[model samples]
Structures are given as C-alpha cells and as structure tokens.
Target: MEWIILALVAGVIGYGIVIYNGLVALRNRVRNAFSQIDVQLQRRYDLIPNLVETAKGYMAHERETLEAVIAARNRAHSAAQRAAGTSGADAGALGAGAVGELASAEAALGGMLTRFFALAEAYPDLKANQNMAQLQEELASTENRIAFARQAYNDAVMTYNTRREQFPDSIVANSFNFTAAELWQLENAEARQAPRVSFGNR
Candidate 1:
C-alpha cells in the first residue's frame, strides 16, 4: 500500500511538470508570434514619414490630412513599443490590455492612411512621382506582411489560451500564474483592408 501511494504521488507530480512545460512552450510561441508582428509594424511605421514627405510637395493644400497621418503614425508607434515591451519582459507578461491598445492605435493609423491616399488621388503629380510610387509599393508590401504576422500571432494566442483553459492544464496554468493572452483585432472593418496603394494609369 505504501509503495502504491508513492507511485501515484510521483505520477501526479510528473504529469504536473509536463503540463507546466507545455504552457511555457505555448507562452513562448505567443511571444515569438507577437515579435513577428512588431517587426512588420515597425517597417510600416518607418515608411510613413518618407511617404508623407513625398506627398507634401504635391498635396500642399492637404496639410490637415498630412498632419493627421503623422499624428496617427506616432500614436501607433508608441502603442507598438508598449506591446513589444510587455512581450519581452517575461513569459505571460503580455496582457490583453496591451494588445487591445496596439490594435486600436493601428486601426486609427490605418484610417488616417486611407484618408491620405484618398486625398492623394486628386494630385496627379503625386501619383505620377516615381518616389511616391516606390514608397507606396513598399508600404503595401509591409501591410501584407503585417496581416500575415497578425494571423500567426492570433493563432498562437488561441492555442495558448485554449491549452491553459483545459482541465488538467488549467490546474498547472493557474498554479503557475500563466495569464491569458489577447488576440489582435482591428475594430474598424475598413481598417481591416490594406490601404489601396495602386497608382492607376499613372
């Protein structure tokens, strides 16, 4: 009877260790996924200033639109920094609130960029500028990368969350304080689409 009880105890402890390791692995996957998004978002943010500068000469009268884009870009960049910091701090440190803030800021930036592009459509010279075309193409490519990264991040979060919530895993997760992660979601439907970067017939 003593040996049987000891064996049972050892088995339970071993199972708990396995669960803990799995949670840690999932958490790290989530962090890695978010970092991928951060890289692409940084790339997109870096392109915005050059894009705005190129437009300034042609869209001189559209100062408000230009300024709005910059303001939005700044806000989004700040939010991204915060989210990245949280993910880097420690395992399970990246909370839902930080992800939500980043998503909101990104959506706002997307809206501003959409407006900037719509306004640029009126300026034939801007649309025809070789520099503008190249920047637009780059921005569009970055946007695609961001989309793919976001999907991967969300998938990782879902898997992590689900695993943590499961019965046997939940026991280990709760004991170890493995907090749930949030999915990056754009609130605006329009913002979900990448801005139209095409310079048609120009």
Candidate 2:
C-alpha cells in the first residue's frame, strides 16, 4: 500500500512537470518569434531614412505623401516600443488594431515610394545618382526582410494559438494564464486596393 501511494504521487508530479515544461516551450517559441519581428522592424526603421531621402530629392512636390509616410513610421516605432515594454500583457498595449493600421500605412508608404520611383524615371539625373540607387536597393531588400519576418510571426502565432486551443495543454495554459497571439493582418484599405490593369489605349 505504501509503494502504491508513493507511485501515484510520483506520477502526478511527473505529469505536472510535463505540462509546465510544455507551456514554457510554447511561450519561448512565441517570444523568439516576436524577437524575429523586432529584428526585422529595426532593420526597417534603419532603412526608412535613406528611403525618405532618396524619394525627397525626386519628389519634393509630394510633401503630403512623404509626411504621411514619416508619421506612419513614427507611429509604428512607438507602438512596437510599447508592445515590447508591456510584458506578459495579453492585450497589446497599443491595441492590435493600431498595430495593424500602422502596418497598412507602411504598405501605403511603400506603394507611394514605387510611385516616386516611377516619377524619378522621368529624371535621368535622379535615376543615375549612385546614392539614390543604393538607397533604393537597400530599401527593397529591407521590405523583403519585413515580409519574411511577418510570415514567421504569423507562423509562431499559429503555433501558440494551437497550443492554447489543444487538450491537456489548453487546461494548463488557462491555469497559467497563457494567451493567444495576434497575426499581422491586412487592413480594410489593403483589401480595397484594386488590381492594377494597364492596357494599351483603345
């Protein structure tokens, strides 16, 4: 009888330990995913200035668009900092919708930059500037990295969400207050973006 009681106690302890460790692993994975996003965001922040300068010389008249981009970048930077500072909070400090709006603004800014480049094509001098070309290349690369990071973040969120919704893990997660993560979803403007169809004049 003594051995059976001891065995039961040991089994319960082992089961609890397993649940704890599993939760920890999932939490760490979610964190690592966020770190990946942070790295990419930092890269984007670093690259934005050069991009702005490159577009400035070429599109001085488009101050409104440029200002919008800068404002959006600032908002995104602030939100990211807040989200980082708010440790263990399930609801984002800046709210998920705000973050999504900032992301949409970045996309709009990118599209505007494309328009700037198209405008620059008319000016051979700007296109030929070595500095502008380099900045453009770096900005393009940074955009690609951001896309990859966003995909990774979404993947991590999915993993975290799955654990929160699963069987034994779900119970443990609730007991410990583990929450699901949000993905970088496109905003309404992004959805409303019409497909570009360039056709020769009829």
Candidate 3:
C-alpha cells in the first residue's frame, strides 16, 4: 500500500511538471510572436518620415495633413516602444491595457495616413514624382508585413490564452502566475486593412 501511494504521488508530480513546461513554452512563443510584430512596426515607423519629407515639397499647402501624419507616426512609435517594454517593463509582458493602447495608436496612425494620401491625390505632380512613388511602394510593402506579423501575434496569443485556461493546465498556470496574453485588435474594421497607398490615377 505504501509503494502504491508513493507511485501515485510521483506520477502526479511528473504530470504537473509537464504542464508547467508546456505553459512556459507557450508563453515564450507568444513573446517571440510579438517580437516579430515589433520588428515590422519599427520598419513602418522608420519609413514614415521619408514619405512625409518627399511629400513636403509638393504638399506645401497641406501643412496640417503633413503634420498630422508625422504626429500620428510619433504617437504610434511611442506606443510600440511601450508595448515592447522599452520603458523598463518586462518584455512581452503586455497587459490588456498596453495592447489596447498600441492598437489604438496604430489605428490613429493608419487613419492619418489614409487622410494624407487622399489629400495627396489632388497634387498631380506629387503623384508623378518618382521619389514619392518609390516611398509609397516601400510603405505599402511595410504595411503588408505589419498585417502578417499582427496575425501571427494574435494567433500566438490565442493559443497561449487557451492553453492557460484549460483544466489541469489552469492549476499550473494559476499557481505559477502565468498571466493571460492579450490579442492585438484594431477597434475599426477599416483600420484593420492596409491604408490605401496607391498613387496611381483613378
């Protein structure tokens, strides 16, 4: 009877260890996925200034729109930095509020970009400028990459959240304080799409 009880205890302990390891792996995966998104977001932010500079000469009269784009870019960049824990927080430990702030900032930036492009459409010379065309193409490409990275990050978060919530695993997760990861989601459906960067004729 003593041997049987000891064997049962050992088995339970082993199972708990496995669950803990699985949770750790899932948490790390979530972090890695967010890092991918951070890289793409940083690239997008870097491209915005050049794009605005190229438009500056042609859209001289549209100063408000130009400034709005730059301001939005700056806000989004700051939010990304916060989400990435560059503010001295633990990396990849984004709470729901942090993720929401990042999403809101990004959506605002996308809206500003859309408005900037709509205004640019009026300036035929700007549309025709080779430098503008190149910058637009690069921004469009970066937008697509951001979309893909966002999807991957969301998927990883979903998986991590689901695993942590499962029975038995929940015990380990709760005991170990493995907090839930938040998915990155834009509030506006239109904002979810890449901003229209095409400068071609209508």
Candidate 4:
C-alpha cells in the first residue's frame, strides 16, 4: 500500500512539471512571433520614404494624400517603440496597440497610393517610368509580407492562448505569470464599415 501511494504521488508531480514546461515554451513562441512581425514592419517603414519619393515626381497634385501617409508613418514608428519596451506584460494589448499604429499608417499609405495610381492613368509618361513601376511592385509585395507576418503572429498567440486557457495549464500559467496573448485588431472601427472610398473623387 505504501509503495502504491508513493508511485501515484510521483506520477502527479511529473505530469505537473511537463505541463509547466509546455506552457513556458508556448509563451516564448508567442514572443518570438511578435518580434518577427516587428522586423517585417520595420522593413516596410524603410521602404515607405522611397515609395513616397517615387510617387511624388509624377503627381504634384497628390500633396495632401502623400502628407497624410507620412504623418501616419510617424505615429506608427512611435507606437512600435512603446510596444518594444513593454513586451510580455499585457502582451495582447500591446500587440493590438502596435497593430493599430501599423494599420493606420498602412491605410493612409494605401489610400494615397491608390490615388497616385489613378492619377498616373492620366499621365502615360509616369506610367512608363521604370522607377515608378518598380517601386509600385515592391510596395505591393511588402504589403503581402506584412499580412503574412500578422497571420503568423496570430497563430502563435492562438497556440499560447489555448494552452493558457486549458485546465491544468491554467493553474501553471496563473502561478507563473504566463497569460493569454491578445490578437492584433484594427483600431479604426469606422473604416470597417465601407469599401473605403477615396478622400478625393474617383
């Protein structure tokens, strides 16, 4: 009877250890995923100015849209800095905040880019410019990468959240300060309402 009781106790302790370790691993994965998203976003930021300059020469009348995109980019850069500092604490909130920053900036940039293209339709010379075409293609590709990175970040958060919310793992997570990761959501609710009509007439 003594030996049987001791074996049962040992099994429970071992199982608990496994659960704790798994939770830790999942938490780390979430952090790493966020870092990857940041790296890609930074790459996109560096590309923005080059894009702005490329678009500028062709469309002098697009001053307002171009300015908005630049302003949004600045705000996104600031928010990213804040997110970096407070990582692992209310990570969901921070991730969401960062997403807000990047999304807002990207939206402004996208809007301006659309107008830039539409305006380009009127100017055959601008359309035929090698630099403009190349920049446009690169910008499109970078946007795709940003989207993919966001998906990866969400996937990591989902795995971490699943473990954190599970029965035995929740106990471990609570004791160790590991918590559920938040999904990055759009900050602008109004933008969700429509197909996003351009500021200027089509």
Highest TM-score model number: 1
Sorted on TM-score, best first, the list reads 1, 3, 2, 4
**Clashing residue pair totals per candidate (backbone < 3 A):** 0, 0, 0, 0
- Cα lDDT of model 1 by residue, 82-171, tens digit: 888888655474955999999999988988888888889999988889999999999999999999999999999999999999999999
Q: Tell how far residue 69 is off in model 2, in angstroms.
A: 1.6
TM-score of each: 0.97, 0.77, 0.94, 0.76
Model 2 lDDT tens row, 43-118: 7777666766766877777777667667766767776776555434553212345446546655665565555555
Off by over 4 Å in 1: 91-93
Q: Is candidate 1 or candidate 4 better by lDDT?
A: 1
Output the TM-score of candidate 2: 0.77
lDDT, candidate 4, 1-202, per-residue tens: 9999999999988988999888777777777877887786687677767767766887788787777667766776666666665566643324445555555655555555455555657756666777766766666666677667778888888888888888988887787767566676644654332222122222
lDDT of 4: 0.67
Instruction: Please write out the lDDT profile of model 3 over residues 44-65, one tens digit for every residue.
Output: 8998999999999988999988
- Name the weakest run of 10 consecutive residues (lDDT summed) in model 4: 193-202
**Ranking of predictions according to lDDT:** 1, 3, 4, 2
Candidate 1 pairs with clashing backbones: none
Q: Candidate 2, which segments miss by more than 4 Å at Cα?
A: 87-122, 188-202
Model 4 RMSD vs true structure:
4.7
Q: Considering every candidate listed, which one attains the maximal lDDT? A: 1
